[model samples]
Target: MNYEGSGHGLARFLAKARQGQGFTVGALGGSVSIGHGLKRGMRYEQSAYSELNMHRIVFDYLDKLFPAKNGRQIGGDNTKRGANRFVNGAVPAIGSDYFAMCFGHHIPEDVDLVLVDMAINDGFSEKGAESYETLLRHLLALPNRPAVINLQVFALMFQTIATGGDIHQGISSYYDVPTVSLRNLLLPIILQNSSYGISYFDHPPGTTELDREGLGTRHISAKGHGLIGRLTNAFIDMRIRDLVTGLYGAELESRLVPETPREQIRALQRFNTYEAIPAIPPKCLSAHSRSPTLIPSTNKGWFKYLIADQPGSIVSFDFVTAGGLVQLSVYRSHNAGLGTAACWVDDMKDKRVIIEARWDDLVSIGYTVTIANDLEDGDHVLTCELLEETKDPQKKHEFRIIAVIR
Candidate 1:
């Protein structure tokens, strides 16, 4: 039951579970490590074929796209089967969408258990909890969905055997699904094993000094991973079989723990920019009834801001006058579009100057047009063009500008 410090115990559990019945396994997340583990568990005679097909597909694609000689890792006669692998760098931000896409394609209805190990990167940011919740909802909605088991890591566990209950709680609630908090299950073992060199045991097959460092940590080591992979595969397969084996007997499984590329042909459409604030001059600038007067003074500067579709979103416009004077300022509520405008001085810098706007509702959005008279005389140019952000939830538009001064 406790898989943390005892790989043998974990492996034995898996082996025993395989006697229950049969089941389909699907894995997705940071990498192919977890799935490989599951494939190894299957203990099926045909696992080699399945794993080979997956390795071929993944490496072949990688080779064709990035032909670096040293990058290739998956080709050999001993290559395992049922170990398909695909990598999507959408670890943190777009994790919800990534998982959605994976399940939407793989893991058909008949699957008994689906295991996922993700969120290591998501927890690295402030918005990780929110993203995880979204992923949970998507899974719960699947009518034919299998039982879900989410695996995770904790920040502090890297060095000690401490608990990660808080992090695990966040994960469990988000998915509203079952989770195997490995932090709780494996911490003790991992801590104990920390002293031992890598690999399941000493004198491992093809043991090398490097391989002994503890079975590769980040992505799972080649040999150590293979061992864990087989154990996990066996465990999950057994669990699934037991869950559905008897028609009306005590459940064999612990708890019925059941379970598009678009083209770029239309270049015209490629240049399309979805305006955050549709190109429109600030209400103040429009009201002033003058395309911002090109101030020749080096003391004044211009700025603009991009705001998201949230209430209280405000874009601040600033201008600094000659003699270090804070001349004029404007605030535009980001209602529903790409909105921008500029200000200028007549005699400060002796030429036009522009600075992109910074939109921070809480920050003092101010810029010095003069900068202690830093503008050396010559034909100066100032320009600002609004940008349209693509409709991506993760993309944040703070500020940007276009200009040229001669």
Candidate 2:
């Protein structure tokens, strides 16, 4: 494959890793997001026509190591179902449970590397982890126990940071796995804004804190995307470099792909907005005065849905922290189009927050809550305090749980 301009960098990165040594990679959780990238990088770095190259590389590597005979399936069938789709397929797989659900199928009898990512969804309880462990042990007992790279869920940043790495360390030792932690990689970046590689876009004044609407859609801004793209390329190159060095002696001559020139990467720092606010824990609920009531609609084995009334109440949340800023604006329906409220949070003498919904009315619904940024850090009380203000008190619906936000 002839790669020019930006593509050349990607090409060189793959070739070096392939010629250096090979690896049979089996990815577990978050296969589509993290593992898909790894497989892509591996194939591209190794040679031209490297997209499905992972399938070919894995097949060849495993064949040499295990050498299958008879009409037996090379790797187990369950794992193969999903893993094979990632190979020789145009579109990447979607959904969180795809890999874990298919665990019984694809894991090979002989494996080299196993990359696992769990905790992506914070709502998943401990039972989910236990189930995964059972499957993991089954795979580990195979002929060759693969080297495991367990990617800690980025969603648990607050919990993990508070533990001083104990949680990750215990997990690693428990399963005898190596942890490829994003926190370790991100600590220095957070310390220095410039070191963050991507610019943190500051929202305009009088806007909700880090709320998607105020910042606009697309999590990363345009400049942020370019910076992220470069950082991703550099990170992949570094990982491949380390893997190659481990497999082959360091003295081996190899062309390591260089990072994108700093000057070439446009920095959006000029427009960076400075705000003093704490980061909200992922998936946690927050409510502000005069915002819509947030209700957990449906429960799916621990994953709860947010439900709310439609067309009259407004809700918003401060996803990011801000210093002493308290102007709250209601969001138009997110799932519904604009200029409509989904639910209502009653104002209590401008002190406490109340949520009101109709129990009698039957409607296909969702959940939402108001989030504000102007409250000072101290002991503040939030209660589920439901009101039966509908036509009849007996006909009113009560919100059982009201998620609190500091």
For each candidate in turn, the TM-score is: 0.35, 0.32
* Tens digits of lDDT, candidate 2, 24-108: 4454442222223322134422321232222333334333433323211323223332121121211122112222223323344
Measured by lDDT, the strongest candidate is 1
* Residue 83, model 2: Cα distance from true site in angstroms: 16
Candidate 1 local lDDT, 1-406, one digit each (tens): 2222212222222332244332233444543222232233443223322443222232333234334323332323221323322221212111332343233333343433345555443334324444344444444334434445455433231333232233434545433344444344444665676533334322334644323223233233334334434444444444445434542235432442222001111111235444221211111111111133223222222233222333223232333222232222222212212233333333443443333343332112121222124534433232222334322234333332211111
Query: Each model's C-alpha lDDT?
Result: 0.33, 0.32
**lDDT, candidate 1, at 151:** 51
Please give the RMSD of candidate 2 to the true structure: 18.7
Off by over 4 Å in 1: 1-24, 32-94, 100-112, 124-126, 153-176, 181-186, 200-216, 223-406
Distance (Å) between predicted and true CA of 247, model 2?
13
Q: Which ten residues in a row are the worst by lDDT in model 2?
A: 85-94
